[model samples]
Target: MEASENWLVESLRLYQDFHAFDLSGATRVLEWIGDKGVFVAGYESLKKNEILHLILPLRLSVKENQGLIPDRDFKVCHGGFSDKPVFDLKHVPETRLLVTSGLPCCSLKVWQITEDSDVIKAVSTLAVPEEGNLWPRLAVFSSMAPGVLHGARLSTLRITDLESQKTAYTSGIGDSEVLSSLQVLGTDTFAFCCTSGRLGLVDIRQKWTPSENISPSPGSGGGRWCADIRNGGQGLGPSIASFCSNGQLCLLDPRDLCHPVSSVQCPVSMPSPDPELLRVTWAPVLDNCLAISGFDGTVQVYDVTCWSGVGSQVEPLFTHRGHIFLDANELDTTPLVTTHIWHPCKPRTLLSAANDASLHVWDWVDLHASS
Candidate 1:
């Protein structure tokens, strides 16, 4: 592995209050435990027969930058044979953590975190019988019922009752295409992006089923390799933000799925630009703002509030290249930033992990800050 430049590290010390940690593994899912200063992440362990999760937190230091300390470690298994990275985790409101993973040996596990300490107690566990083998590509908790977990199980959407171990409902997410990402819109509604270049809105209430799905903008050449999907937060109600496979960021209003509010050419990752390497997420504290990663070993934050419908390129408000340092030639070496997320309670604070097993918890000090 290559090292960052001394000059760049020196510059990062100027206004970047950041800390890095070695997770010893790579994870696809990262979720904050509500407003707490802690978060949970999980990934497959090739050496072990199962997956391991870490409840890690950043320790605020007065004398130095914050550092991530491992709080707890837990294991969830019977999913070692999954073909794709299907391990996903989400925090439910009732002190419960919902998790799903597995293919040939499918299983779902729920754990309860006590209010006293980080000790996670196993509340429930269920194994999806081999007869149905409904592998989950994406999973999220149902806002209406804490016991229900909804997942995009390949060809169909499965809303399973974790308490009773029964399939509550099933519907088509897309004609069997892989689901890239899923975001909960409301109690019984969700927005998702499929590998087939389709962004869809599905609601369980009102017996909702759409006859058609929406495609990307016309200028996108009719092919969308959607990498990620997220709901626009704060004041943008019913607003959806999706990073297309074509490297174009799209603003969408779920009320009219067929038409996009705007489409702009977002920056592509350096060295290699692939949809699978890129991810998008909106901030809980900022409006018309979102973060994009897997772009040349850095996370770029942009404010779309100023996006003009002319299809022009929008510049990022902040460019975070802390993951990789420029060589003497000033080019990035480790160019893939695996995943990034915004702090639920802290404004402008970001947590990101890279392919090199480096986890970062950093806050950019805006000289001219905004609310």
Candidate 2:
């Protein structure tokens, strides 16, 4: 592991005063996209300043010397009704299109960044379910060359044209349930993890089907906590790393769906005994090593040779003092660690967000002293 010598800090200033309900510190980072070497992030802030407010997209630039800079000078893309917006933004890597979800009145909006105009021009807009809180899910399929681009709501997943708001393909997941996460498994396939503890495979080329499934415990805990599905593992198809309730980690191949190659129960003697709220991810560049973090401050790195292989657990490379420390009853109000986003431009570098409304950048560097 390597360490970072320099650190930069930038604050976008959520709002002068709280704007939302009692959600003074609830912020969810939806997407982080980098083009060439420049990076942009989009997230939703529930409390703007100090007032109860609607959600809106917060944008920032990642640069070496500039630290974190707000995209204030960039052209603003508008949609929906809420003056405040809750958004899901994704970059079409092929076309370089910026797609956004959740505006006061708008559901999905596509925009083109014009270099000459230094502005973001609205490309197209699509209508979506306006009844429930509509959060957009984004995924890309590369099977058909550049792959099919799609989005999923709580009940439906549909493909949309970048230049036209027309629906290319649409499938239903029903209205009574919620989708926890969505990942593009292949050129024509996608994996959906639902709040119902249901994991289903959707084929964009065919009618979406339950090609594979994993049921969690009944009630609210059955849904997946987090997922890492990409084609880097030793397997030929998509490999899944999902955190299930009760401290169980299940790794499966969505291509086979019939069974998981391996499963591991989180070791009990963790730094913190609280139920594990695990966040699992595989490095985009590294296939052998995977990173896992839990509700406690421990971060584990694993050499995934095989699912059931012995002597696989590598030592925990590092421990983080999670942003906040609190008692059991204070969990709800605790300054929870929300996410860890690896730097797209810098390998071995990571960014973390916490309930304290702060973002910290970490680099994997050796702390061993000289002899």
Candidate 3:
């Protein structure tokens, strides 16, 4: 394996006096759309609603002699309702649509970013029939169909059309398996991970039949927190990269959902041993590379091009420890890496959010050289 110590890391400030538990009570709420990043945080005081949506332009420029700084050319803040933690944010650049979901609420709000006004305006809001504390863990926008949004609410999955402000389809994943994450596979197909440690694929065109499920080995611990479909140049039909509760990273082909094409263990062990709160995503530009983050407060990147079978073992190409606390005495209080997002256009650029309410941008220098 080739290793390089050439990585540039930058710390970004989101909100003043921000606390992680105040707004969302969780982190994985960062999304990158075009040149802008949308983050959800909570206000410090109780006078206003807790949830605050921050829109930050992510472009960077080098000053004549001031090195590099984010081109703070534009910034916008939108207020949300109280006690509604924004659990997920997704942006569809093609449609200029922004979708957000809050926990304990069944409502999904669709907004449009107006270029002329440099503001986000709500286009429509659709609420699911059910009401619960953990409904709608995440929302995913489909590129195959403009204005079509998919969401997972506890054991149920819902699909809505933003143009009509109506739900197109809804189905329950029986046996009480709560959904943890969602991914769009194709125009009519999508994949979801559940608390039962099973990965399922559903085709919306097929009336949401009994999903084809993949169960991990016995005693491997079931429950997949996050799954992302690979967008490589390879001709594979919608391969999946999933992070499971057993501390396993799995790569599977949705066409053949019975078995995983590759399965490897995560290097950074979770500090709390709770595996149902992690995230995994494929590299936007790399064919077989991906990243995983969890309660470990570290991010790991692995190249699975050589993965062949169940026992296949692949070491991470890079391990990012920038989120770890530098003070030895504060090791016990180290913040977890809530989520990490790859640049939509840049091959080697990645952004990660931590429980400390800070965002870090990591640029892999070696990967850029080879690309």
lDDT digits (tens) for residues 319-350 of candidate 3: 66666632222445776777787766666567
Identify the candidate with maximal lDDT: 3
Better of 1 and 2 by TM-score: 1
* Backbone clash count, each prediction separately: 1, 28, 3
Off by over 4 Å in 3: 1-27, 36-83, 112-124, 140-148, 151-155, 172-175, 217-219, 232-234, 271-276, 326-332, 367-371
What's the residue-level lDDT of 371 in candidate 1? Answer: 39
Score each candidate by Cα lDDT: 0.58, 0.48, 0.59
Give per-residue CA lDDT, model 2, range 152-242, as digits (tens): 4445666765544567777765744555567776556667766445667666666655565655533224434656775543357437776
Clashing pairs in 1: 225-245
Error at 42, model 2, angstroms? 6.5
- In model 3, which range of ten residues has the least summed lDDT? 13-22
Task: For candidate 3, report its TM-score.
Answer: 0.76
Q: Which ten residues in a row have the lowest lDDT in candidate 2?
A: 1-10
TM-score computed on alpha carbons, candidate 1: 0.76
TM-score of each: 0.76, 0.64, 0.76
Worst 10 residues of 1 by lDDT: 72-81
Candidate 1 residues lying further than 4 Å off, grouped into runs, are 1-3, 6-10, 13-16, 37-45, 49-86, 102-105, 111-135, 142-144, 147-154, 172-174, 219-238, 270-274, 326-335, 367-371
What RMSD, rounded to one decimal, does every model reach?
Answer: 5.7, 9.2, 6.5
